[model samples]
Target chain A: MQQSESQSTGAVGARSEQEPSNGEIVRFDQVVKRYGSNVVLNELDFSVAPGERVTLIGPSGSGKTTILRLLMTLESIDGGVIWVNGEPLSHMRRGGKLVKANETHLRRARKSIGMVFQQFNLFPNMSVRKNVTEGPVHSLGVAKDEANQRAEDLLDLVGLSDKIDAHPTQLSGGQQQRVAIARALAMRPQILLLDEVTSALDPELVAGVLDVLRNIAQTTDITMLCVTHEMSFARDVSHRVLMFDEGQVAEEGPPERIFGDPQEERTKSFLKAVLENG
Target chain B: MNWDTEFAISIIPQLLQGLVVTIQATVIGYVVALILGLAVAILRRVDYIGPVVFVVFEFIRTTPVLVQLLFVFALAPPTVAPLTIGISVLGVHYAAYTAEVYRSGIEGVAKGQWEACRALSLPPLRVWGAVVMPQAIRKVIPPLGNYLISMFKDTPYLFAITVPEMMFMAKAIGTEAFRSMEAYTLAGLFFLAVSVPSAVIIRRLERRYAAV
Candidate 1:
């Protein structure tokens, strides 16, 4: 099933460079991350299958966002290995030795993954169309005309076709985030990582961005690993939900099972607090 | 202090010729400074050589420009022209200062911009040239213009190395006439004429980019 799904998306570009031995698109085997003396992710283990949608829910310091940051290579892991498409991400094979990856190796490994930041990190120096087209033309070697056309289509999909020429500073927070979404999708990545994508928006503007994301979830076969505070959106889009506590998965199951009838004490208390505050 | 109107009027052609030399040195030296400064700024970010580059630039920044001009002039071969040596020395000296200005501008860019570039898997060259440089250069334009004006004023230092710049011509006129008042006052006026307008332009630029 994963093979056929990846092949269907391969028509956009050369995405089948590596064939996964297992069906998992992303896997962490005993991964550990630290900031000084603080251990953020301690022997964490999880996996996401190809085309699967997974949401990580936890309190502020529970290491949910750290998982996404590690996958994107924004922060390096102190121990263990990360696998993407069944290939080691944090290390590379050199004369039969698994050594830490260099810049060139990391660049090759990062091609299949894309991330949407919470701050909607659009290039303020460029127009909306150029922001979306830049990665495709420069990184993937797509032709200028084709990248421009694809950018237009993406802007239309995000319901911002009229804003193709506007600067990011001119748009509202929600509009900027939609443009960010378009920019991420323009790369044709097999795995998309969303890190509290709508956390910085005004209260009234959250629904519009969520609707755009819902549209993408329904339409594409791309694998999504999302860290979000919106519980209803998580339950609506996620196939599985993981409740994290102290850098470990406390409970994991279908959304209906985890949210409806949580089994762990930590998960129960966490959900109770969230429900009351929300 | 008698003002010599006729003497000052007579030396206009010579002063203009010296002014040409001064303007040439400032423009060429500034071009070199802009390029070398950006290179130094980027090299300072490299892990192994960053500290070495920082110490070398700090040494240059602390010393006097006149001493540097003399040191290079003494070491250069006789085959090289004094003007050539003077221009090179001035360029390298100001590069140390401009490098600091560029460092602040580069650091001023938001951290998220870099993460976005990495997430898109954009190459290092494209990240700097296409995205980072454009934003960094825009924010530093006003400070860069101030450096240009400052470099123009500093051209008088080249007279010590016998570069025959404006101040050199003024001293020659004073010695020939046996009166220092007219020539010295004209030289001061020339600097004011160029610097005041440049300061105004830089102020305007600061206001415009500040709004962005």
Candidate 2:
């Protein structure tokens, strides 16, 4: 199931990962991003292997979400290139010179990646079925019946099959977030970007969303990059957890090593603060 | 000079004929305004040409409808029908205001809504046509209806183009019979009869839909 999803989406987005490139699904090479005078990401470099679940944990404004946003091409990087599935997203090679990508280039390059924002960001104008089906039908030009069938499967996977016709406004925050997850997956993104998916929910609602995500993480071989404040979710769902500080990776290891054992002072301080409040 | 019952009775049938023209002008003029206004609003979102469009919108909006009526009437070809001239004048004038209405409506949709469409990899055309405009136009329907009613009342300004709408008929009757009170009073009554209910219905619609 995971291989088929990856194969189908690989055909949709850009140059497919059918050609091997050393097993890296996503790579950011010396990436620099800035907003006015505030540097959000400075010389950041990281790579996620295909089918690995990586979690980035940090305090606010540590530039973790910025990394996800760059991968999604929601914002362009000021320096360096972002390569997804071995294709350049930030710049295209034209006549052996790197040039900034135009709109068409960016759109095509970004199809392999899907993002779930902190806010649910579901289409308020559409029903849950349409919200999930819209991208496949329009962007992928998939047949309506085929797209509808896939939407049903995804909605069922998220445990919202009963609310297919419900509008986004009619659903609870957690339900809407689940619908958002289904919508992103319907595109069959090879690498799913979860940007603090459970951060916006109420305490009770957070657990439901987390459970759905945990199931996906365990079952799918899709590469996953998540940024979250929920330490338990990070520990449970992630293959590896990276502690981020001031726009760089401070420490990273298997979740057991990062969470159970003490290492760097900054990582120790962040973990202590988060646990104390909880 | 007084409310002459005899003069009022004689002008009633002629005034009714004039009312039909008034109604036709208002309806056609509004369709033109609505389409043109929405076009200008949507087209102005393009970065390369947006400033030029906004300048043109401001120019048309700052000018008076009466002045616009006279200008279009004077410049129109002799072969054109007077009624078409009248409708076009009103259409262009109100379109300026309605264009602003559409701009505010489109912008009023929450920023997150746009980001969702973008993240879905929906093209720009699909984003605006399928997602953004649907929500925006729903919110602006009441305001759009208010402008429709305003355009209906403003049809009287068509007298400059000699289309013989209700007000033109009233003035012509007053000249011939020298009974301004009776003819003008009846015209006001007809306008009152149409506009009051239209306005109340529009207000009710605003309350019903705009609250959400």
Candidate 3:
């Protein structure tokens, strides 16, 4: 089951030279993560294909966001290896045994992954243009003028072109989040992780942010693994949806099957609960 | 013996010269403190050697700046001047306090900001330089300004090493001309002159940027 699932993940991004064809963009091979005595991800196995939009949804502590955090390398695996583009993210092979990867290794692996957080964590000290331009100019060593142009284009894409000079503190929450979206896309990662990106916004502000994301989903071939409680968004934008239960994927299928005709009792209850609350 | 304008006018040049020395020591020492304090804060935050760095910072912060000055001055080479030693002592001593301020400022930054940098795969240096310090430094400015004022007032301790700072010249002028009242009053005025305006500026800055 796991072998075939991983093989399917490897067959995406056929158009890109940087992204190798038939290589899983991200894979969790029996990954385990623990915080002291509490096991957050229990030997989980999952895979996300290049350009595929996958969403993880469940109750608060079901470890859905942890899946995104782990892929982004924000958290480490306690056991098992996580692969990004068929290379280990949390561990490296040495002398025929798996060993923890070093900082250099983690840094190299992290280049292809970008994450947008729930809080729209824009650099409060920087302007919108600077926040978007910083990663490419600093980390990727892109030319300053080119980075500025790209930032302008991205800010336009997110509908924040007029607000580029404004500091994060000066913008409203929705505008700040759109700027953050532009900031993440400026890095041009093959994989983007969205962890409840609109959860922190006011109810009136949520639609604007969601529209930006849905537009990105329709336009970009960037592989996205999102964790959002917005059920309609999961139904609208995702190619596949996985319902997590206590650190493991309890139900997984295409959105129509998962949301329309869930097989598991747990997934039905979760979807029902979310809709009732919404 | 009386409050004589003639004597005060005669000694004004020496007291002004000493005032220059005092201002120089404060500016130079505060710069050192600011830079060294940031370095110490970074050392404490980074992995490996945290406990040892903690102990070293605590020791420097708890001890008297005057005592540390005397000790570092005694151990100095013949080539180094007393002014330099006094400044170094002032810097290292305040560095301990500023280190704590920096740590809190850095900590005051939301965890999401740090996570954002990690997600972007920014190098550790960029994380601190571009993402972290900009936010942290804004928070630390007010406290650090207070320390600069504190260091300025404490420059009198440099008199113990015969650096000829303001207080030293004041005492020298008093002992020589028996005009203790004018010399001491002039020295006090100089200190208040520098300290009051700076404290006001720092307060205004705090109000201006505190929203961040």
* lDDT of all predictions: 0.91, 0.87, 0.87
TM-score of each: 0.94, 0.93, 0.90
Query: Model 2 in CAPRI terms: which quality?
Result: medium
Candidate RMSDs in Å, in order, are 6.6, 6.5, 5.7
Residue-level lDDT of model 2, residues A1-278, one tens digit each, is 99996664443333322322778888887788999999888888888899999999988898999999888887888876678777778876565445678878888888888889889888888999999999999988899999999999999999999999999999999999999999999999998999989878888999889999999998888889999888889988899998888888899999999999959999999999999997
Candidate 3, B1-212: lDDT as tens digits: 46888888888899889988998999999999989988898899667787789899899989988899889888999689999999998998988999999999999989999988887778888898888888888888888888888988999999998899989999999898766999999888888998999999989988877754
Cα lDDT of model 1 by residue, A26-124, tens digit: 988778899999998999988899999999998888999999988889899887778898788987765544567888888889889999999999999
Over 4 Å off, model 3: A1-23, A95-97, B77-80
TM-score of 3: 0.90
TM-score of chain B of 1: 0.98
The Cα error of candidate 1 at residue A129, in Å, is 0.9
lDDT of 2: 0.87
Query: Scoring model 3 with DockQ, what do you get?
Result: 0.66
